[model samples]
Target chain A: MNFFLGIKIFFRSLFLQSVWNYERMQNVGFVFSLIPFINHLYKDKTVRAQKIKTHFGFFNTHPYLANLLLGIVMRLEEKCLKNEVSQEEVLRTKTMLAGPIAAIGDRFIWSTWRVVCSFIGVAYYLCSGKEGVWYQANIFVGILLFLLIYNLLGHLPLRILSIYWGYKYTNNVVDKISKFALQSYIVKIRNVGIIILLFASFIYSISLISDLKIVLLFWLNILLSLLLSKKIAEVGIFYILFLLNIIILTVTNL
Target chain B: MKLSLWFLFISTIAGLFHLDVMVFGQFMFSRPIVVAPIIGILSGLPEVGLIVGIITELLYVSIIPVGIKIPPDSTTVAVLTVVCSERLIDIPVALFFAIIFGFLYKYIDIAQRSFNSLLLGWVDTAKAELVEQRVNLLIIYALFITYLKTVLFYLIVLPILSFFIKQVFCCWIKNLWVHMDLYNLIYILPAIGIGIGLAHFVEE
Candidate 1:
């Protein structure tokens, strides 16, 4: 029964953002996903309704990392039902865990893993070149590779492991997560992946700029880009480079 | 370079489903990298879509939607760029317009989120009335509103924009392409990508 509940919750958790709103922000979806477990646990309709209503409070987190919170909350709620813990304790657990997990999740998944995968995807797409069926085939392969690697390696495993660890460790879940040092590992892996991908991109960029003057202009743009403070949006830098490209091409006729 | 209603219809629907990623699957089909190429293929120009998608992806690599901060809607920008410019405008020019549209659409996304709060009020009423099923209905309503926003934006915006590109920018792009070394233009894109990649390290 516990295994079945875990399976159900895991599936439901994937839809955690379905009914997102500014006010409560995933509160509805959170409640929705927990409904089956709540139903199974509570015998009385009133108590069940009360349990469900309690979850209607503001709840937001990184959607993938949310499964961990869900599992921990489930354990806390079970204790509450058994009178081993108070209702306030359960609510407090939810509030406390949400923020930290969101921070980690956003950093690891959104910033690191996503950027790494995209760098790989862009590298593949660029190296495939500009024309013919071969290029088209490579584009499709690159997209498929991105989705597969990201979902299989990063998303699905993290979600399942989060749920498992959250339930098994309960209140000590943070310690368990820290002990594993998942964040550091992710950062390390991402750093290596990005370095390799960036090297490939660098070589590709060099090969594309065959003319000497254009190479000088390219290096100038790189230096100029490096000088621009990080406060400026990367998109803005791209536009500047694009405009420079047009001007250089027009003037040099290379 | 005439607009194909068939492509427009398909793109609108795909765009609507893609917006559902925000609320539903989060499967990332809604991402510019994915959606742009799909649009390209549907419009029978997968190569254009793929190239534009790569540039857009690299350009926006660091801009993830963390917490409540909504980034520019690059997916829409990408779709519009690929679909509207098919044979009319140069890819680079189309990309420029798409970036402009992307910034504009960010405000639209914010407005849609604000509008969603009103629907949340309705969900609250349903909960208070003890009509449990109505809560589900409200969730569906929210999803529908999201779908409507994407479809309406695409349907209303794309055709007119395509027309404008055809009339105003086509000749200029054609002239630029004729005068410039195509290799230089092509090389510029990956150069931007490399710069952005290097910048990513700096930001970190």
Candidate 2:
């Protein structure tokens, strides 16, 4: 691949979720990102259009890791053009790779990395002290810190490299991804996230320390959250607690 | 007049954030940690935004939008909550309305995704010429329509919800502030979020 075409595919891959329909789920987006590659591979309009038609099948995967699939598929399409690989093999690779990549990407990026980074950001904001004149400046900095940590450490490298890695390894990129032992890292990050969450929650809950009743209620909230978590999501617990707080405060007349 | 203009501004920004969640890269930019604070800072309620943002973020942090399953529209909740909070209505009541809007917004996404399936038909049967151009156009049109749907959702829903919450709040909680410790309630809301957040990491 030329530098310009790689750059084209990289940028175009960012729009991989642009038309995420429930029916086929990112098939159009996958085809869209590969347009340049198709045009480059097939010289005739009929052939190019036929190649496009072949790729319009169902395609879905985690957005960030999609370039890996795109890169692999691009390579496969090229190989198919050369008659070294069958079209079924190329299509099968897409369907086969998508589910595993999506699982890894979802667990790593969505479940672990994003959670850990934002937990740190929220911690920073709590430590910055929310009661003073500098709170706005503090929030601004906290937000900048989050956006920086996430994009710089995690997002940028993944996005810029996913396609190249996929193209280079083709079907074997899973071996490359597995060699990282991301499961261990995901566990470690989640453990660290727990620490950050506890410490930050402690910091944010400090104001209630002076009010004995509120402190008890705060601890009780934590216990109840733990107990009921499996039964309902945090959001549901949030609503129930919020309504209860409002109701108790008003009914008891504080 | 100034407040009206700010509402317009906030709603427009909210629509863009929704686009980030749906169409654009699912960058953490669309996360409540970012969206709520931006709306809050712009509305001169930075602290409320920060607190609400934390709570909303934690509430949503565990959700994975895997496969075709649609997560609740937490971004919409954060955006509308921050926009309607404190200035137009009380935070707690605004939150209730915002959560309702959040659920309602999912219907919009469901509808948009279904419509996108129709657009899928266009690409499935495109002529031999300029199929790439047709796909590009369809993607752009889908994005534009999603943005418009979200913006219209904000424009139409924000006012009605705010009004409804204001009336209910005034009748119930507004005059009851003599017995209310609003800050306590606000502080505990995040405690619940943190508790739930803890549950997320600690389990399994």
Candidate 3:
């Protein structure tokens, strides 16, 4: 029954953003995902309703990492039902875990992992070039490979393990997670991977530019844009570069 | 460049899934790199889709939603760029309009989320009444609102933008394309994208 409940919650956790609101942020979805476990633990309808109401309070975190919280909460709730733990304790645990977990998830998954995967994807597509009988096929493969690698390798394992370990070690799960050392390794690997991909893409871009003057201009433009990106919003820089291109083209034609 | 109903329908569904499923499943399909190519392939212009996707993806690499602050909606920007570019306007022009609309849609998303808070009052009342089913109903309502927003955005914007490009700006764009070496322009956009991507690492 515990195994079934964990799997059910995992599936429901996917809908973590369905009813996202400013007041409570992922509260409804979080509660909804844990409904099965809540029902299983609290046999009485009123108790079940009470437990659900308790979860309806403000709860926001990265959606992916929320599964880990859900697993840990389920274990705590089970203990609470057995009079081994208090309701306040479970609520406090949820509140404590939300922020740190969100920070780790936002940094590692959103920033580092995603950036690495995208750089690699772009590099793959660029290197493939727009030629040959299988050019279109190559592009499709490159895009799919990025999606597969990101979802399969990066996201799925983290989510599954978080859920599993959250259940296995309900007490001090956060400390265990913090001391895991796997995340640091992943970040290190991602940093190295991004650097390699950037160099590859730069070399490829250079090869494509035959004219030395144009190549120098390209590097100059890249440097200027990089400096501008710090001060200006991305969209702003995009518009400026775009207008510059139009103006340059118009002048060259004139 | 006639628009196909099938392409429009598929793109809308893809847009819906990109936001909806991506949020739920944590799949990166919502990213421009993935969404653009899928839309491009469906529209029978995979190359344009791939190019637009890469540029948009790189440009918006740093725009992750860290906490409460919402990033400008890159997925919408990408889908609209590819779909609109299929008609006739240059990819950059399509991208420009898409970026504009993307910001517009971002505001709309914020408004929608704010509006959703009103629904929570109903949820509270339902909880008081002990009608837990109402909460589920409200969730479905919220999801529907999200779906409707995407569908309506595409249904209204793509055709109008395509028409405007075809009617008013056609000759101007054509003239620009004729006079300009587009190859050089293409190289410039990606270079900026690469620079932005690299900038994130350098900062860290």
Candidate 4:
């Protein structure tokens, strides 16, 4: 692929879900992303049309990791055009890799990395043991830290690098990802998140400790959340707490 | 700045950041942690945004947007919570209403995706030359629709809801809240979020 065409497709991948639909989620976005590449590779209108149609099946993956798949597909298409690889292999690669890539992206990005970054930010905000003090510059830094670390370190570079790795490694990209041992990193990150969260809670508890009942109440709610998250939505838990608040208000005329 | 100006500005910001949720790169921009504080700072109320953003983040920490499951729109809740609090609404009450609206917004999200399905047939049948332009058109339509829906909702609903909550609920609950010491109740929200997040770490 021409370097400029690769750059164009990378930019287009940012809009990978601009028109996601239930029937073929991300298919439109995929077609839109690959159009520049198709135009670059195939001159004949008929072949370009056939190539476009080839990718028009159900396609959904975690958006960030989808860049890797895009790279691999582009590489596959290049080989297919030269009759080095069969069209079926190109299509199969897209379908086969979609599930695993989505799983990795969802776990790493959504479940692990996002949680870690959010807690790091939240913990910083509460670290000073101040409540309702919004003017503190530390809190601003805290939020900014989350955004900066998450994007600069996690999302932005990963999107760009995944494309490079996927293209360079081709079908071996998954094997490369495995060698990186993302699950172990996820475990370490989750552990750090848990520590930061606990420490932040401890800091907050110090400020609220004057009211022993309130501290106990706070712990109770935490216990409730831990127990109820699977069974109830956050909205339901929120209202339930409100209902409990009504009872507490009625029972104790504080 | 006028309240109308604030509404328009915030609506625009909300729409832009919300694009991160699904319409574009999952860049974490739409996460409550990122948008809430910025939106909060923009509205001249940084504390409200930070606290709401933190609590909201912890609250929904366990809810992952994996696969077919459509979890509650925590980003919407964060944006609405900060926006609602900016109008001098009580943080807890503001959260209540925002959660309701956020719940409703999830349905709107599902509906928008469903509507996008309408163009699938055309995409399948279009000629090659037409396919590129048509896909481009569809993307613009999808983005425009999402942005417009959020902007219109904020423009119309925020004033009425803020007024009613300020006039009606605040009047009744202010003294009661002070007496019961539930003002500290907002603190517990983070605990719940923290707990849920802990569960995710343990289980996931």
True contacts kept of each: 0.42, 0.70, 0.48, 0.68
Model 3 misplaced regions, further than 4 Å = A130-137, A211-214, A252-254, B1-11, B21-23, B87-89, B127-131
TM-score of 4: 0.94
* Ten residues in sequence with the least summed lDDT for candidate 1 chain A: A128-137
lDDT of 4 by residue, A1-254 (tens): 66787778878888888887888889988888898988888898878877877787889999888889999998998899899999999989999999999999999998889888888888887766545443344656886788899889899888888778778888999998999988889899999898988888887877777777778877888788778877887667778876686567456764
TM-score-better candidate, 3 vs 4: 4
Candidate 1: stretches off by over 4 Å? A129-137, A206-223, B1-4, B87-89, B127-131
Q: How far is candidate 4 from the true structure (C-alpha RMSD, Å)?
A: 2.2
Clashes of each: 1, 0, 0, 1
Candidate 2 C-alpha lDDT tens digits along A53-120: 88888999989899999889988888887899999999999999999999999889988888888888
CA RMSD, predictions in order: 2.8, 2.1, 2.6, 2.2
- For candidate 3, give the DockQ: 0.56
Model 3 over residues B1-204: C-alpha lDDT tens digits?
Answer: 346575469556765755643245758878888888888888788877888888899999878887778888898888888877754236777887889888888888888878877777665655433646766676677667777777877777878776776565565556657556654565567767777777776666
Candidate 4 chain B: worst-modelled 10 consecutive residues by lDDT: B83-92
Model 4 residue B19 distance off true place after TM-score fit, in angstroms:
1.6
Report the C-alpha lDDT of model 3 over A53-106, residue by residue, as the tens digit. 888889999888888888889888878878899999999999998998899888
Candidate 4 local lDDT, B80-165, one digit each (tens): 78877744327788888888887788888888889888878886798867777777888888778888988887788777767766
**Chain B TM-scores of the candidates:** 0.86, 0.92, 0.88, 0.93
